[model samples]
Target: MTPISSLANPTIKHAAALLTQHRIRKKSGQTVLEGVHLIEAAIKQNFTIKQIIIGQSALSHPEVAGLIEQIAQSIILATDAVYKQIRSLGTGVDIMAIVEIPTPALGVITSDCLILDGLQDLGNIGTLLRTASAVGISTIISTTGTAHLWSPKCLRAGMGAHFSLAIFEQVDYEAILQKVKIPLYATSSHTDKVIYQHNLTQPIAWVLGHEGQGVSEIFLRTATAIALPQPNGQESLNVGVAGSVCFYEMLRQRQFAQH
Candidate 1:
């Protein structure tokens, strides 16, 4: 097959737009997945892959070649120059796919879950997702002000954790407060209650908030506030670090209870 060498090609343009524009991704109900690992994760999770684009030079890579063999559908090949034009995350990514975004239905929170309230940093958003997934948190809800979960930077930072979790984005704060059946917990510097002392053995929803301003007042008012003990007297921890500590503590408590 002749490689698509032109940057002006419709397929190239579409992928570029999906990578750069949040509106385009939302309207199309699709997003671009870059690199071999993310595509592999998407396939493992049975996500619908609309199209695959491979750089011509990457065809010889064993992993890339192996992936190509596993995929039964026709793939578009692009010259190195063409692929470079559309690549978003930087160098060394020669494979990408246009996939339908998974819209997981949010039901009753019967297990550990996460609530991202106005968290704006893409890296923090991704880190929380990864940590939550690691600690076996199956569901995550992102309020309107949070960063886009499927954005290229977030997706890259997540390292395929997105595939393993049911993430609901752009949800209303009030809706979640009313809908979640489990206890809501938030971490705060002002709170006298420490995380280790809290009862985290039962099913609960962790509400993580903005990096600077912290959790929203509405959520804080509704949630049981717990603070991680800082002996050195640091002002506050990054949201990602704080959330990871909380998730693991919950996991540890549940594991101990199981014994």
Candidate 2:
């Protein structure tokens, strides 16, 4: 099969738009998965892959070739130049897939869940998602001001964690707070209560906020405020780092209690 060499090709343009524009992804209910790892994760989760595009040179790669063998339909080939047009910067990925975004319905918060309150950085958002999944947290909710979870940058940062968890985006904090039956905790540098002082074994909701602004006032006022206990005289920790610490603490407590 001849590789698609033109940037004006409809499939190339559509994939490019999906990668660069959140509005196109939202409207089309699809997102682009770059690299073999993300595509593998999507396949493992049984996500509907609409199309696959491979760079001509990547066809020789064992992993890429192996993936190609698994999916028998909807494959398209592109020249290296055309692939470069759609791939993310600094990434040498040669394969990508347009897959339908999973829309998981929010159910009862029976286990530990994470609430993202206005976190704007895609890297931070994605890191927290990866951390949450690593700690076995199954659900995550993002408030209106949070960055798009499925965006290319976020997805790349997440490294396929998006497929393993139930993610709710653009949620209303007030409404979601009402639905959460478990104890709610929020991180605050000003709080005297350190994270280790709290009992985290039980199901709870962790509210992590923006990098600069911190958690929203509603969360600070309503949720139990706790700090990470930085003794180095630092003003604060990165939101992703802070949240990961909290998530692991919860996991530790639960594991200890299980014995």
Judge candidate 1 at residue 26 and give its lDDT.
Answer: 90
| lDDT for each residue of candidate 1 in 107-221, tens digit (9 for 90 to 100) | 6666778999999999999999999999899899999888889988899889999999999988887778777988899998878889988888788999999999989999888
True-vs-predicted CA distance for residue 119, candidate 2, Å: 0.6
Top TM-score hit:
1
Q: lDDT tens digits, residues 1-259, model 2?
A: 8999999999999999999999999999998999999999988988888999999998889999889888866999999988987788555659999988777666667678999999899999889999999999879998998889999889989999999989988888777877778888999977798999999878889999989998899878888999999888899999999999999888888786545
Candidate 1's clash total is: 0
* Cα deviation of 142, candidate 1, in Å: 0.7
Q: Clashing residue pairs in candidate 1, if any? A: none
Per-prediction TM-score, please?
0.96, 0.95
